[model samples]
Target: MPLPDLLVSAIALVRDRRVLMVTARGRDVHYMPGGKIDPGETAAQAAAREAFEEIALDLDPDDLVELFEVVTQAHGEPDGRLVRMRVFRAETDASPSASAEVGALHWVTTADLDRCPPAGAEVLRRLAASGTID
Candidate 1:
């Protein structure tokens, strides 16, 4: 396997609750809101930009909350042929605004997340255990 570049992903939370879960058009898995960090862009900047482009929600780099970082593959990402994503976590009062590239946006509770996507569920559990969120 070519293997994907190392990536960092973030889970968006609001009022100590996770707010967004992203699913591509054909994907059954619901991942967090995040994307690749451009060579010149800082991880924080990339997080905000990706949120806007992927969901039409404008976010400030400062709004990015430091969630645990993880590495994942981009072989079948909805966008580019390949990429390395650096993810972050933040809270937003705004609802998810979809862009052309995105298929659906769902607001989920920490409890609900577990049933929707196993991978996301596991991450949330870890983050919760780490005191990142309640």
Candidate 2:
């Protein structure tokens, strides 16, 4: 059986060769620092909002460059839910600290991508293959 699709926005904050990943409190799996778009919110707006909520990284919505969008099984959701993630890339030097539901923030290089969730794994793969992030 297939899950109903979910729409969400995700942001990739890349600096040097590392991208930022966050883990929710009490959770072990890592994910990109973004979340579901609110009603009437655009993808970029949601990405910016989620970034600030999760990591305290204040980003301009206009600064986000769309990297890609993918549909994948929602990692922690019920069995019948899928996520359509719109990923964006931005350059930021501000340090990211855990906030809101985020427990910790980790800088993930190409070698550390395996620590991420499925959607994050796909984002990393696409970024790596495109040479957007090493």
Candidate 3:
């Protein structure tokens, strides 16, 4: 039997034709600033909590707009494992800095997709195709 999918919630913060991405401590691949949805937490709530924890940016759960979802082979996982990521778009006026598990922050364009994990690359592709980011 196949392993169950890993579920995650992610937030997209686009600015000036670029979207925010982060590298977790000890990881080279970039991903959106979010993480696994905790028990008893809505996806939106998890996204917001992760934004604050990972990037030091507080986000209101009410302001998160469901952007897209991606299911792809899990990066750094055993073969046949998959990840299901729920992506959300949210606007914030405050600057984001690396925090918690984050090691570095980057504002990336679609051209940088190769530096991301499979699911994160897909998010960049869709965002660029929609003209939400360059």
Candidate 4:
């Protein structure tokens, strides 16, 4: 049987027509800053916590606006495994740097979608279609 879908939360921090993306240590594909939701934590809270943990960004859960959700094949996992991502868009003035599991930080436009996982690429495409990013 296929494994259960991975549940995750992600944040979109866009500025100047670009959105923030991150690559985990030793990984080449990039995605939004986020991870699995801990037990008893809301998706928004998980997203905020992941942002801080992965990229050293301080995000308030209350400030996150639900942008959209994506269901796609889970990157780095078995072929049948899927990921359900709850994505949010929020404004942050603080600078983000690579930290924790994050290997690097990048500000990417739609042109860089191919560098992301399926779910991440879908998020970028939607953001671009909505004019949220270039």
Q: 1 or 4, which is superior by lDDT? A: 4
Checking candidate 3 for backbone clashes, the offending pairs are none
Residue 5's C-alpha lDDT in candidate 2? 82
TM-score per prediction, in order, is 0.68, 0.89, 0.96, 0.95
lDDT of the structure predicted as candidate 3: 0.93
Candidate 4, 1-134: lDDT as tens digits = 88999999999999998999999899889899999999999999999999999989888999999999999999889998999999999798899989968889999998998899999999999999999888
Question: How do the candidates rank by TM-score, highest first?
Answer: 3, 4, 2, 1
State the C-alpha lDDT per candidate: 0.62, 0.85, 0.93, 0.93
Residue runs of model 4 more than 4 Å from their true location after superposition:
none
What would you estimate as the lDDT of candidate 1?
A: 0.62
lDDT-best of 2 and 4: 4
Q: List the residue pairs that clash in candidate 4.
A: none
lDDT of 3 at 52: 93
| Tens digits of lDDT, candidate 2, 16-131 | 77778888899878889988899999999999999899889899999999988988888878875888999988668788889968988887766766777778888888888888
TM-score of 2: 0.89
- Per-prediction tally of clashes: 7, 0, 0, 0
lDDT of candidate 1 over 46-86, digit per residue (tens): 77878888887787888776655543335445433344444
Pick out the ten consecutive residues of candidate 4 with the lowest summed lDDT: 92-101
